[model samples]
Target: MENNSKKIIHKGISASSGKFYGKCLKILSGEHLILQIHISEDEVHHEIEKFENTIYLTKQELESTIQKFSKELKKELVEILSSQILMLEDPIFLQNVKERIQKKLENAPLAVHNTIEEIAERLSSLGDGYLSERAVDIRDIGERIEANLVGKRSDYTFLENLKEEVILVAHVLTPSQIIHLDKNKVKAIATDTGGKTGHMAILAKNYNIPAVVGLIDITEKISEDEYIFIDADEGIIIQNPSLNEIKLFGASSKTDFGDSKFKPKKIAETRDGTRILVKANLESESDCDLALKYGADGIGLYRSESLFLEHPSNNPTEDEQFHAYKKIVEGMKNKPVIIRTFDLGADKFENEKEENPFLGKRGIRYCLQNKNWFKKQLRAILRASVYGELSLMLPMVTSIQEIIETKELLKESKDLLKSANVPYKRVKIGIMVETPAVAISPDVFTKECDFFSIGTNDLLQYTVAVDRNNSVISDLYNPYHISFFRLLVNTIQIAKKQNIPVGICGEIASDTNFTILLIGLGLREFSVSLPLVPKVKKIIQVIEISQAKKLAKEIMKLSEEEKYLEIESYLFNKHLLNNLV
Candidate 1:
């Protein structure tokens, strides 16, 4: 271990944004449990029995955990655990383990371990971060099975037993392990593996836990119980910090979204008093409450996919969807709630697999193909609209014809509700500008749709023809590309000219670096994650709209490589770097 009195800082990628000061607790990986175990031919039957029992036990454990944590954790985390439970019960995985144990005369634990290794290797070799992260899930299940067979449960007992707060340092954490953590004791998390989209990362954000992931060899570098400071917003881990550094971090840690510095008036406005509607992009009812707590003007993007994904065995009924949508709409108390129809098929529904899923049947296209499911969702939205202000938005819409078809479906749904004497309010309809075709010709949509929400994440991916999840080509997925900026500017300009309400509900909307640029492009609405509402609000409250326009004009003239540097310099000169870091 290094000197505890010395100040040592390490930098890595920021997975969840926050600050924390606590002792480090290093967690060991399950790789050590992969040792070989030989068994005689006659013992193979016993081993198979043990394996089957262990599988059953693991499934029960996951189900119980899911039931226990379903309400306590975020909906997404619960769904992740549910998926793992399904994997444990998967026939293919079970058969493979059984075949290895019976044909090779191997011990159950070893057979399970080998099967997981093979599957994990194949998943990791796909070169997609989302799929690669599932490898962790496979290993987690394998470890659970092995632990059950050995009559020992290798859970986060250390976290459960902790008396004082600590920053968990580990090679990686599965979604279940992360959800099972006692947040009261685990103040923050630092992982040597995993990316921003990993299960652990999502859990950290959903639970409001500060985390810094992708810190290579973090477990090896930090000693147990050593006091450290984690600045998750900047992705910095300071080990053995000096007294002054500790004081600074402590002061900064105390400042959060709740601080008066970030709190805005009833409306979000710049220093020059340019009003910008800062709304929240939510997934569940809890998120709607969190958004209001964080001072969101309204719910901009209410992702309806969770309702379907949560119940993989069956689609949510019309009443289930109506109640779910009503809860958010009524909670907002007349605040605008834009409910986006299920953006399914692409990495969402396991049944809908494609060679190129990104460009295949997804979003609006998937909903259109499954017309009954689409109409059920529409009917629910229409029924819920009477409770409060609700708008229906379609995702991945590329053509005016798609909008026309969606309107026809809406009419049919409304007519059915009318015939049944189920009163429904007239809901406004909108479209997501996610592809180049929509962005290039915003005028076509302005006439048909009530509003436009730019999905920059998808738009960028489509514009550059790069897979954002592919690490090898991630650098090419640049948002500062001149083409993307021009498209964005053009779309915003068209919306403004047509007097159409336009907003951005993508990763870029939450980014402080692009906040000024977006404001300069005349975007008056920003729909971001719950935690980002206050930070973006603070940024909007500080910038002058006229200056932002000037900055945007200057940025528009730069080449792709120069834009990043220019923005960095501009932010530094304006002293807005503090808000970002």
Candidate 2:
């Protein structure tokens, strides 16, 4: 770790892709590292009272934080804090801490700490990295409560005083901690432990901050104010890099991007003159703006869950939702904005616990169960449609009956708006083809909906019976599987026969390797992340439709066992597998 010694390189998983060179700023969560304290039996009741008061105070602090950032921060960022607030108020989490205080005759802080550790341990033991990552949130809440009991602040105040930009190096950062940091002062982020789906990681991507996580001992090896080079795209961190190395890396980074030469183009077309519309999946206002900057054809999937998450205590009023949607619609001008209804479950909305949340009441089903909430969102989407071209998309539709019921409710919403004499436009309705049940028979859905957006993330998961979040079986979740390709082809063909527009808005869509294959499968529209627009567009412009079709035909003929290797070998040999992601 000497400054004058040889440059040290460490590797980890890439959470967000970008390159950054900045000084290191190490952070430690002191509140969560408190020493245990003992208490007598008589102090049990008093301890429970102390714990309750701490919880109450922590909730107030979280609410105050949410209020402070409600208007200034992106809705998704605010939601991450709101989710933490919900965790603070969770009955099971609160009740367990209290029981530990009373039954174990421990102090308030000790009881809270022990309960959190126990729950986090159990979560990690589930053998699912995604579920285990939730333990970070749990630990964050417990630390907040403990900090309140100990009369200490939950955030690291040192971050506020930093005069220069630096790459934050930490063992782990809670979502709230990341939010509390001065984003302008933090050039990038590197963490010892975190998951891609964690709130901290999500914030990094949303903010366009270069970050790498799960670097087991980065904080230990990296020192304060050390010059570090973060090549997040390759998941490498160089500590105390030499001047020659720094210059070489900087030149290489600039050449790779070619900022001056690479201009954003409007049309994405193939060599044979087939035009493919490349859109962006947006979650917040900033994301909408970034999409436009990246030359997105339109906002393909405008997730409304962030709006709900922004106001955890209550559903956003119809007027509030309308204004929110209107801003994005107006911003996009002539471009279509497909706003999806809230697609979360009770776990996020109601803060209710579920054993298997993926299969539980979620997406459109949750909206139907809570009809009033659904009506408010529908009314909002309809009211905003007049501002620009807009569409309404339903998520998690497993049956035609769900679509039928939703259409009826949409009518009710329109009627209510009509009664109010509100100026609105009729928006096209669409369904997200995520499950195999829907993908297998998309023709039935095509008959009822205006369009079909294949969500390959869930479709592949549901079709292959593998959880994408579970790192243990992540290898088993293959997008190259012949079964997945068949499903994609089937859905696209069914939609094509009906003349219904079909687009893919999933993780796979953003992948450049799959772009040619998707185009070959007759998919003319793609919705990817903002950063991926240029690369995907580049791939589309270079390939011819006929060549892609030939590749697709060759792929479809391979056996289930041979498809994976065959397609991979084909793309590799053709040099179409070059890293663009």
Best by TM-score: 1
C-alpha lDDT of all candidate models, in order: 0.80, 0.78
> Per-prediction RMSD in angstroms?
11.5, 13.2
For candidate 1, write residues 1-581 as lDDT tens digits: 32445466687777766677888888867453555778788898888888888888888988888888777676667778888888888999899998998888778888888998999999999877678888998888777887888777577654666788789999998776777778888889999988766788778887778789889999989998877888775577987654433333332333232345455566789888889999988755645656776799999998788677545354889998999999999989889999999998756666666889889899999889888889999999999998999999999998898889999999999999999999999999999999999999999889898999999989999999998655345557777788999899889999989989999998778666567778988899999767777777887876688878877776777745565656546633445433432
Task: For model 1, give the 10-residue run with minimal summed lDDT.
Answer: 248-257
C-alpha-based local distance difference test score of model 2:
0.78
TM-score of 1: 0.63
Separately for all candidates shown, the number of backbone clashes (residues 3 or more apart, or on different chains) is 0, 0
Q: Give the local distance difference test score of model 1.
A: 0.80
lDDT of 2 by residue, 1-581 (tens): 22466566788766665667888888865445567677788888888887877778888988998888676566767876778788777899788877877777778888888888898899989877667778887787777787788887666556666799889999888776776778778878999997655777777876667788889999889889887898665567877665534432331222222244655467998767889999987756545666776789999987787677545345778888988899999888789999888989877744677877788889999989989878889888899889999999999999999999989998998898899898788889999999998999887887789999999888999988998545345557767777888999999998999999999997677656567778888999998766677777877776788878877777677636665666666544545433321
The 10 consecutive residues of candidate 2 with the worst lDDT sum are 249-258
